[model samples]
Target: MNVSLILIILLIGALATYMVGDKFASKIALLFGLVSLGASILLLNHYNLGENIGLFTQWIAKPNISFALQADGLALAMLLLTTALTPIIIFSSFGTEVKNAKTFYALILFMAFAMAGTFLAADGLLYYIFWELALLPIYFIALVWGNGDAEERKKAVVKFFIYTLAGSLFMLIGFVYLYQKAGSLLIEDLYQLNLNGTEQIWLFAAFFLAYAIKIPIIPFHTWQASVYQKAPTVGTMLLSGIMLKMGLYSVIRWQLPIVPFAAKAHVTIMLVLGIAGVVYGSIVALKQKDLKKLLAYSSLAHVGLIAAGAYTLTTDGMSGAVLQMIAHGFVVVGLFFAAEIIFRRYDTRTIADMGGIRSQAPKFTSLFLILVLASVALPGTFNFVGEFTVLYSLSQVNMGFAIVGGTTIILGAYYMLKMFQSVMLGETNAKPFADVTANEGIVLVVIISVLFFFGLYPKPIVELIAPSIEEIVNQINRIK
Candidate 1:
């Protein structure tokens, strides 16, 4: 199967799910999500056998843009993340009530399609288009379906929409300039453009602005916590889980390689910004009373470290970023789902209002505790493997960078455990807090399983991403 089939499956699924109406939309979305996951698996197998599954054909002859989709190991790994999580995200919403269920489910599938395209598109313009398209579904999902006061939700969502859209325009300008110099917008062509130091610096800033805002690294992260708190749980999941990775992935795939000299020159600044986000995010997370907002800041901190690793310009750093990207996706989704679970039962997200859930729901407490431990990168969980590798890569750059970046683990454990104790421990709430239903249990089980399984046996992921990351590192260090 060609890589394009995955996109086609999701697009068709989106349309079909919408047309089938609300009653069947969720099931259909889940089915299509599973099918797409299966398709990605088949493509991965073909890719492993060294069969070409990517698509490349002429699109707009005038602009020299082609409809290209490349499925190297790195892209496929991301595609797998997108597909695997789509179903889980959908399934997580199964028992929850949703307004305009058809539109909601369809949008989720479409967002999946857009995110997959973003990962696979090899043409710079195509990738940009996919990147922006991913925003639309989430915007509507947050604005229309989100919670909180109407005006407040609007303010938050609009700020997010404007911040991301504005940042992306800078990136588009950079791509336009690159197209002028290279005579093509294909990624391979862009990489070969031997631009001077001045040009590289400009292009680097443009792309970095876009990525930093999307990755929502510190300073550029003002829009994050409010939006995360306001958006529906599913929308929050899509944003935190998959959409954030789009920016980090682009740094490796687009930014660093095309502007190697500038990237190399500015490594220290990048590392500082990344670690700053780590510290800043973690500290802010400590003060959050709202569970989702706390997790939002927590996400900011985690991605900050991931971005730091990507900026380190080493193979270990890049691979660790990718591995952590996948791990963070699952863990964050589970954590947010846990928040949703609490919100569902107690009808409150305030940490102050929650208490003593362990007495009522052992299964939920156990799973949530495990997820919390994974978030802190406990030694045996998948998060540890990624966090440790990222830290080691930082150390190779500078011990100071590693030391500051490592604060994420310690600070994360502190706030997450504190939140858990407040929400799940102490005197039992007079209101009933049920154990996780079978569906909820299944979702948490699946997430924890991936964490532990990969934690112990990360060789598969490490091996899969190594060659691709090595190529990017070579490209970054190669000077014309």
Candidate 2:
């Protein structure tokens, strides 16, 4: 089957889950989630064997857009991340009380479908459609199912919607301009256009505006922590675990390659912005009193570094960004899940309301500790591999950049460990804290296993994505 099967499966899953009703919605959703993951694996195998799994065909001939999906090591790696985390995200919801399970599960599957399409679509307009489509389900997920005051949650969700949609309009404008000049919205065609410095800079800014907001770098990040605090844990997981990667993936896939001149010239500016977010996010995270909000800022910090690595325009930088994207995807999901676990028992997201759970639940405490350590990029965890490489890439650009970016590690450790101590340790609360249930244990174990396995042996992943990273670097170098 072609790569489209993965998308088709998720689409069908959404419909089927909705039709099957609430009683069976979660089950069907999980089943479909697993099946989609299997399809992605099969497609990956076919791709490895050099079989063509991509689809390119006419969709709208008038505007020169086509229904195109490209499958390469890089795209498949992202597809795998989307598919793999979906089931875990779905299963993670089983512990919580979900009103209107059918709608909730269906939206999750549909979001997966859109995200998977975003990664695979090669035609520029088609890619934009998928990119925009991914935002809808999350908006509703956070708005309707999200916690907190109704008016406040509505405000946060609406702001997030407007911010992302507004940013995407600029991107849509860029694509239109590219299509006008190149006579096609296909990525390869856009890459071939002989744009001068001015055109390249403008287009890059347009696309960067969209990506920067979605990646929520610095000033544009005002919406993130509130939404993360308001959204349901499952919604938060989907956003942190998979959706943010869409922006990072687009930087590697569309932005840098299409406007190498601007990317090259502004590398320092981008690096500075990214490093600034790293510092700002880390310090803010240290001061957060709410657990989810702390994790949200931490996400901002990690993604800022990833963005910096991508802008470095070196193979090592791009590769590290990809690795970190995958590593962050899993780790953030696990960390959010841990927060949800605590909330499930204590009914609070405030750090002050939590303490000494370690006394009651050793298993939960140990798992949470490992995730915290992983977040800090301990030497043996998968995060270290990605973070170290990113720092190395920054050092290649400028020693000062590396030194500044490296603060994420030290600051990340201090804040995360501090959060852990406050939430998971200290005097035992009078409230009894039970260890994780079988389902919860399974989720944590599965996540930890992947982190440790990849930490020790990342060769397969590194090799899978190496050629693609090399191609991107080659594209950047072609500017000369």
Candidate 3:
């Protein structure tokens, strides 16, 4: 029941890396990342499966909040995603020269720790604290080591930090209201609170603002494209890979259950908005000259559909959302790293300025093409499974809505393929191009393996999370 081990190991890993000199910082951080990933993997063994693994103790007598960490199937799936990705994230940065390497890598580990804590927390206040802690490291990562003009970077970083922090405050107020109503901050206590329809609406909005800002659904997403483009590729990976999922996971775990009536009442228009993001982000992406920003907007489109699936309140939709989060995470990171590889070689990210790479580097071209297919959710790729499941869930709800949402597949293919052709194919560039290195080859191989492995056999994940998603649906229905 000591799921806190993941947090402790990660935090200690961050500190231990700092105590060691900069010479070995990245190596040490990667070691710790692997160690944490090992622990989570061990937990997934059948022997360790059953009752929730948690550490619970009293921390504050006044507020009645406990130092609590709970891990169930849903939480464990997220923990697995975070822990598994952190190592790849660490591995992804090994070749780059990072100043103050200790600090930079430590923040990455700390970010993992905070995100893991967010997934495992059983107390409302504890969850909020971990949620906010997740923001600080990425803020620094983007501010200090991020790319682009100094003034522009500062503006984007500050705007992102302030926007998300402001959203958190509203969520905090919602938690506090639930606390007052329930007389305790335990999630179970909050779940049992007998709030009225009016109260539920307020709580739902507050919590939605927090999650939506992080997910950056639409209007609240002003900071997403800028910060993503300005941040280092690894930072962008962290943001796209695991950070955005926190908001999405919260929507399913925290918001919907606490305010089921509000969720039920407002879900139609909210879903329409989610579908709107799909159209808006795609059309915007179609016009993007910058590779990173195009990927960012494409991400907005992908997550919009996931958000819409979540609010459907159907078992199939919730299951698809969880599945899609994992799918999107791996695909997005691979895509960003592909962009980073291009930047490393060509010193540019503009799609218009690139061509004929496939002629020189067949290996890199093949990998990039695979990711492009995965992103567009080509049949037999991992994303297609989640996308199909979600679209099916939507179809069950409203065939027309599913049809609108389904256009992402078409639009996704149109833009991603155009970018792929512009950058990876066609007439030779005057500049020389090198094929994928052993390191880059290994990373891409791992990514492709993961996408296809579950792409073909997603039963393990589906079985793991299905019961929990069904429980959540039941919870939503039972709310008074």
lDDT of 3 at 142: 98
* Predicted model with the maximum lDDT: 1
Model 1 per-residue lDDT tens digits across residues 187-208: 9999899999999999999999
Candidate 1: RMSD over Cα atoms? 0.8
Please list the residue runs of candidate 1 whose C-alpha ends up more than 4 Å from where it truly belongs after superposition. none
Candidate 3 stretches with Cα past 4 Å from truth are 46-48
TM-score of 3: 0.98
Question: What's the C-alpha lDDT at position 294 in model 3?
Answer: 99
* Each model's lDDT: 0.95, 0.94, 0.91
Better of 1 and 3 by lDDT: 1
lDDT of 3: 0.91
Error of 1 at 241 (Å): 0.4
Cα lDDT tens digits, model 3, 183-297, are 8888877777778999999999999999999997988889999999999998999999999999999999988987899999997988998899899999999999999999999
